[model samples]
Target: MSLFDKFEPLNAQYVRLEAIDANPFAITFDHVLSPTEAMIGDSRILLLGTNNYLGLTYDTEIVTKAVQATRAFGTGTTGSRIANGSYDGHKKLERALKDFYGRKHAMVFSTGYQANLGIISTLAGKNDHLLLDADSHASIYDGSRLGHAQVTRFRHNDPNDLHKRLRRLADVPGDKIVVVEGIYSMLGDTAPLREFAEVKREWGAYLIVDEAHSLGVLGETGRGLAEMQNVEPDVDFVVGTFSKSLGSVGGFCVSNLDDFDILRVACRPYMFTASLPPGVIAATMEALHQLRARPELRLRLIENARRLYAGLTGLGFCLGPEPSPVVSAIMPNPETAFALWSDLLKAGLYTNVSLPPATPNGLALLRSSVSAAHTPQQIDHAIALFEQTGRALGMVPASAATHASHHAAASPSLSVTSA
Candidate 1:
């Protein structure tokens, strides 16, 4: 049998996925929304699958700056930053981030994945060891692998497990990097940052917190989980992506270590990859300014999350621990999750379908991400649709193993929908 034939099976299998639609699933002028909201494909559909936590995607000021910078600097950087791609704007943004996060130094990367790749792989050589949460993002795991380091996965969100791994690694030498997410992408759960910080201190290990989804969503100033828990000082390094809350596409690494600047010279990924485009850097800088200046945005985001959580629960949908922007309605398998996602789309709603490998143990998830820009009406409508489609799938039927619990909106909490 041909190797290419193996790839064809994937196509044949998923092609008949239920409720699959052909049209692009983005929004247009038909929807009453800010410029950023216009980016969604399903215009009339309720937006419950976006990571625009603070919903700063369409601030006119940020857009205008992006336009002006693009006009002046052109579209592409045309060269790697290590070569001739570094512009005054790039340096300015880097300095601005250092000041914003109150860190000694910060380096900007083309994308968030690259940030982890460049940082982790550079810090952890072949001789070092990497201790990571089982629930870490794929980027973190891949970067650890690329480093050629000895990788060990600890239990998800379990500090005790991390402690055990650290104790074992204490016998090893060179560097030990402990990696965890600020807010897990699949389960939407947060790490016990303070507890992990203590373990890192006792074990003499370096800590790296990836704040991809948490930045601009957590903390009063929206710095992320470390900032929210007042454990910023304890974390040796902080990595974040601009794609989610910042309403832009970029990544950054901040550290107190001076040698990190040398990563520009030493890191192969950083040296090889082209720098972020001028327009993006411009928009990103503007987004950072807004993130720091507008704490009210974070408040509005939290309120929206609370309201969405309550509504989802009232409609008998399970949610994540605490009121996170990313809430999931988990199903037993991939087929079930895909069907629910399709139904939600048909019901004028949009969300993500998360399945195995991405989510552990083959658990399929109809993940909903609440945005600050989402109105109460939108959330309520989404809840009703979720309840309606979920029931049709026997999700709430008495015979289903996961149908034991009932969700009520009267409580001030998020109920996770799971099997």
Candidate 2:
């Protein structure tokens, strides 16, 4: 009888999670010291759940650029891009992104979610087809709903399934757009981009690669999975966000399509939403330059990821497919996952706890992401903490805990705590 009645099920679930000290939907960091450290509720916690892959958030040069831009252009762009929000800095940033991706056209949106929504909804129209990975992000799914396309979902990372679906639409008269991500956010697993590209070509479908998690962490030049897989030429569009590696807020879609500029008026999300602030645009441009100049950051990030992954696996924890910027430890169930997550937080480590329905195949996850700014010592400290907490919670065996303790004791600077 009330408007709030629809949320009864979700409210019950939230209360249950809260009772167990596992509710992670709302958390706040009182102080962010750097990309890898933050203070939360009187505890100085190691930040492992942030997507700051390249760790440029605290870079002095980038900060200076942002400050200068804010002083010059004021705080915000109050109007949508279609109206008074179009500024010279926004245009300049678009030009920079265009050159960075080697694309003929680039359009900027207020946020990464908007970029996916705008691009997907505009590209696939009535009677058209929108094929997406089953494990795609929520933005991709919502974008499909906003459009009039008949959506199809294929198995995640299974190129054969994608090909089969495309083959089924052979007789269809409308255009087809296949959407995938460079790196899946939940599992941190990469797509078979080469195979996907091949299937798109065979089916004559447009391909869109969302590289939000892969940018600045893949390829020699950091163009993401498409560049690493050598399939850049096959991809019709590349969507990415500045909030991740760039340490700023914004989104963009770049393409070489001749009529790409027409989306300025056709894409509802882009045209209706206000553009990114001038300060963010300026800072993102600087961050891009920094990412390009320092290829070593990517190397450091992967090395940290591998070290952390190996440490967790050695301690008898299940992990993702491979070492990546994001490392997730799977738990036996939601309860166990929540317990471990709470234990980790109490041990001065902040990680992301992903529950069922949000995770793949209903598996819960304690997700941790590595950043280039994380020192070797910090990574080892985090490993020792995980070992202590995991062992206390019965997630790790006694023998493995003893082994980890012995290893920790051998290093004078490393100490394992029971907290």
Candidate 3:
């Protein structure tokens, strides 16, 4: 059989997507105008797809820090920290993370995915067991495969199911680690962390909360869902990426566990991957400072999210359970979802289209992440656009268009801040 045979189904899907000029995966932004807007082809569109939760990507201070660091340390670190040598900035960033999380130790990885790969694979030894939420991110599942641990998946966000799964392995001779996310990316629903923590404690299992989407978007000071749920102590490790709220590149793992530094030598992904550029580290450090200092950003983000979520709901569309920065509208099917996505793009609105295996239960999603940078006017405009597109495509009732009319009319003209 040909090596390419396995991808025939995927190729067929791509062909279908191409037929309607709705290849969401192939979108290219010609120019990014700001955290809230970008140019696609010749048309400028509201940027609802990018996960810039706090919208610090275009902050002058962060950008200045990055530029200064690039000038001082050169463009990139040519080798891995283990091989070449650790930069002072790397250590400083790790220390900042430890202080931010109030943890005893922290380790930085070249990428967020690597952080999961290194930590999960390294911590779960051959004799260990990993109990993961069934809807855990692909990185978590991939990490399990890279290690020798016996893996089990419980029902998504169901603590009782997790408890039952752990009970089944009560007698299993190995360390137990429960892995989950603070905020799931697709649907934007948060895990019941307090309940999960209780389950973990009852079973004497370690807990890892991946806050990739929740960082800088949740909690009183943005320590993520563990802090918001008041279960920080129960979470043995907090893994996150700077790519999201921080608007930089890299991943980090913070923990109170003893001898955590040993992972520097134990994790092959950590050892093999090149270290992040000095500029990225500096930019991320500045972003972290901003995230902690500016709680208003979080407030604005949630407010924007509520507006969009409510607006979409008013338009007679099914959406995620709660109002979150990642506002996802459930589509009836992939075809309708693809058509809506294309129409939205053509109408100067850009949103993420999640389909098939990437989405939970093979569902189709028109996902849009609200940003602190988005003005109320922009949010209302997006709603109006969705109303128009949905109605035109029969995805929403014709009468649904009236729901957004008042808000759209009251919304002032769109004005995007220059990045």
Candidate 4:
């Protein structure tokens, strides 16, 4: 048997998607005009699926810093951080992260995925225990497998289930590390951090919160769910990414543990991977400054999310339980989800099409992440497009489409019937 045989199923799926020109995975924007808009083969597309929550990708200050750094430090850092890759920008960014989180130590990685991989895998040793949410990100699961720790998954967002699992390990001797995300990527649902924190404390387990999606989107100071829930003090580690609200590429872990710096030497993912370039580091630092300086961005982001969530809900689309930056509409099946995503793209509204395996509970999703940069008119236009497409596909009701059309009337520049 060939090693490629295992990919036959995926190849079949791609073939089916390509037959109708509905391959969501192959989409490439010809030009990104702004955080809320882009061009795909000359078609003006409203970007609804990007995780640019604060929408600072085009900020002049951030961009300027990035350009300046690139000019000063060249294109790339060719070596790993443990070797010759560590630069001043790297250290400054780590210090900025530590200061922002009020933590004692901060470790940066080349990518957000590596941040979880480095931290989770390194901390949980052969004899340790790794207890994570059942729907934890792939990075977390990979990290669990990378280490010798015995991995156990509790129910997603169910603190009671976590407690039960931890109790069974109570008699065990290994250290327990409980990992959870601030905001689940699929459904946009938030973890009850406070409840999980209580469980961690009750069981004397260390808690790690991956705020990859929630950073600069939650908390008064944009510290994430832990800060919003007033459970920051109880959390043992906070891991996040600069690619989201920060609008760059990198990952970090911040903690108050006195010996947290030791991970720099022990984490294989951190030690072996090349450090982020000067531009990314500079832009991320500037973005952090902007995130703290502009709390209004956070307010506008939540307001926009609520608008989209309400609009979709009014159209009879099932959505996440609460309103957050990430808003997703549940689909009945893969075919329907694929159709909706393709139709949405053709209608100049781009969204994410999430299928089983990556998504929780084997469900399909038409995911849309709102940005503060999106104007109310743009939001209305997006809703109008969804209504038109959903109605055409017979997924949304005719009456609901008629009712939703009134909201689109004010968006004079955008046409609801683009298709």
User: Candidate 4 lDDT, tens digit per residue, 1-419?
Assistant: 99999999999999999999999899899899999999998799999999998999999999999999999998789889898858999999989999999999999999999999999999999999999999999999998999999999999999999999999998999999999998999988888888999999999999999999989987768888888888998999999999999999999999999889988889999998788998989999999999999988887887778778778877889987777778889999999999999999999999999988999999999999999899988888888888899999998897784434433322211111111
Tens digit per residue, CA lDDT, model 1, 102-132? 9988999989999998888889888989999
Task: Tell me the whole-model lDDT of each prediction, alpha carbons only.
Answer: 0.78, 0.87, 0.89, 0.89
Off by over 4 Å in 4: 401-419
TM-score of every model versus the real structure: 0.89, 0.95, 0.95, 0.95
> Which scores better on lDDT, 2 or 3?
3
> Using alpha carbons, what is the TM-score of model 3?
0.95
Q: How close to the true structure is residue 283 of candidate 3, measured as C-alpha lDDT?
A: 98
> Which stretch of 10 consecutive residues in model 3 shows the poorest summed lDDT?
410-419
* 10 residues in a row with least lDDT, candidate 4: 410-419
Displacement of residue 65 (Cα, Å) in model 4 is: 0.5
Model 2 steric clash pairs: none
Tens-digit lDDT track for model 2 on 1-419?
99999999999988998787667787788999999999987899999889999999999999999999999998888888887758998899999888888989999998999999999999999989999999999999999999999999999999999999999999988999999998889888888899999899998999999999988888758889888888999999999999999999989999999999999999999988778888898899999999989988887887788778778877888888867888899988877877888888889988898877778899889999999999988888888888899988877887774323323222211111110
Q: Which 10-residue window of candidate 2 scores lowest in summed lDDT?
A: 410-419
Number of backbone-clashing residue pairs for each candidate, in the order shown: 13, 0, 0, 0
